[model samples]
Target: MTLRIGVIGTGAIGRDHIRRITNDLTGGEIVAVTDVNAESAKNVVSELHLNAKIYENGHDVIKADDVDAIIVTSWGPTHEEFVLASIAAGKPVFCEKPLATTAEGCKRIVDAEVAHGKQLVQVGFMRRFDKSYRQLKKIFDEGKVGEALVVHCAHRNPTAPGFSGDMAITDSFVHEIDVLRWLLDDDYVSCQVILPRNTRFAENGLQDPHMILLETKKGIRIDTEVFVNCKYGYDIQCQIVGETGIANLPEPQSVLMRSEAKLSTEIYVDWKDRFIDSYDVELQEWIDSTVKGEMNGPSAWDGYVVAVTSDACVEAKHSGGIVAIELPERPAFYDQGNNKVL
Candidate 1:
């Protein structure tokens, strides 16, 4: 049975998701889509020839009884409402990162999920589905890397997302908070943020770069470098150092040949180019698992952890020092590393 999907937003990533579902993946079809820009939404629907119904707003799309699952790719501020509405309708929802703008808002979603007595929300942290990252996790589990000790992560964007300095932590590097926590299977205990010397390449108002130091509950440490306007490439790389070995993501394309001294393979300048396959795999798995009454991605607990840690990191950034992160005790429901009840 094809899972009926309703997509909200129809912006860059939103429209890409529609294409992925309608053109690339099976077991799912986009039935309806909504965007504040009706012109763009209609153009997207027509271009895809999905015969998808267009709505004036996201709520109309999600509220349609025919939508089995709703994808909340709308503006970040609007995530909480659409997610809760999907829950009220008893339909599964996949919301993008920064689940809510604030910790309390995320907690409300968590409360709703718990009240519903089942998992109905999956947060979009696509790094968890990337093949290279998955390989690193397997290596850690296999003990080839011995006891996992530290993880170094970098998220560099070729350009800023037309936002202010504050959003650098909330909207941009939030993926690091989500995926790193998922990889280590532990909650963050504290976060320390630092601003490096500014880079001139960034637009004057932007911060250009920052650093986040995170310590997990089980004592795993992560140092993250976030440079929004790197003037280099869009890169997401991590190196996990264990007692025995070190595993890191290979630079996406390593085949460098020098012909005219301008050696280059390809530097992904955007998320679409860098994580294209991961995005496809991520959405495909979600559709497949939802069809089977299962989930194959980050849960509400994961979202909560990321939100709490992000909140702490933001505080640390503002206070100019380390801030303690207080995460709720792990529930038994999330103890499994491979999606099984412990």
Candidate 2:
């Protein structure tokens, strides 16, 4: 059965998802879409030649009978509303990041989904689906490494033009907050943020480089440096230090070039080029799993956990002290990772 998907938000990421569902993937169809900028949404429909309806607002698309599932890619602030509505309507929703702006908000969504008595929401934590990360996890599972001792991670961008305040923590560093927990299969017990010298390239006094220290329940340490204005290229690095061996995330497949005098590997400048395949696999799995009435990806509980973790990180960023992360024990509802208990 084809999953008729209604996409909310026609921004760059939203537009890409629409294109992918309609043109690239099977088991899904873009039947409806809406955006804040109706003109831009219309332009996307025209350019893609999508056979989809342009609703006046996102809620209309969510309540449409033709849409079997909903995809929320709008501004972060509005995620809670649409996600809860989709839950109330008993439709599966695949939401992009943050899940909600606050931990309390994400908790609300979690309660609603739990009361609904089914898995109806999947948060967009794409790194868990990336091939390299998958391989890294397999190494851990297969005991190639004795035990993970420390994880070193770096998320770099060529430059961030409009970033300010704790956006780096909330917007940029949140991925690490989510994926690291999944990678380790442990919850963060404490967080501390170290603010280094601001990069000269930072716009409007934004803290360009932040060192976030996280300690898991199992005593494994994960340190991440989020440097957005590196002015070189988008680079994502992760290395697991284990008792016996080490595993590093393989960089994107780039040609080894022996240039004028040095051998170099290409680094992508745009994020889209970096994890495009992950996005494809993530959404395709979402489509396939949703069709079987199962949500096997990141759950709403994971979103709430990440929100709580990011909240603690931001608190550490402001207080310059180690902050405790207090998360409610995982309800049995989420005990099943890739399967529903019911």
- In terms of lDDT, which candidate is strongest? 2
1-342, model 1: which lDDT tens digit per residue?
999999988898899989988888889999999888888889998898987898888888878988899999988898998888888888999998767778888889888887887788888889888887788778777888887789998888888857685777888778888777666666778999888999888784877688889998789889999988887888888998989989887677557777787876877887887788889999999998899887658877777777788888888988998899986665665554254211
TM-score of each: 0.94, 0.97
Candidate 1: give its CA RMSD in angstroms: 2.0
Please provide, for model 2 over 1-342, each residue's C-alpha lDDT reduced to its tens digit, 9 standing for 90 to 100.
999999999997899888888878889999898999999889988999989999999899999999999999998999999999999999999999989999999999999998999989999889998988898888986888878999999999999866778888888888998888787777889999998988888887788799999999899999999999999999999999999999998878889999999999989998877988898999999999999998999999989988999999999989999999998877888866572211
RMSD of 2: 1.7
Pairs of residues clashing in candidate 2: none
Which 10-residue window in model 1 sums to the lowest lDDT?
A: 333-342
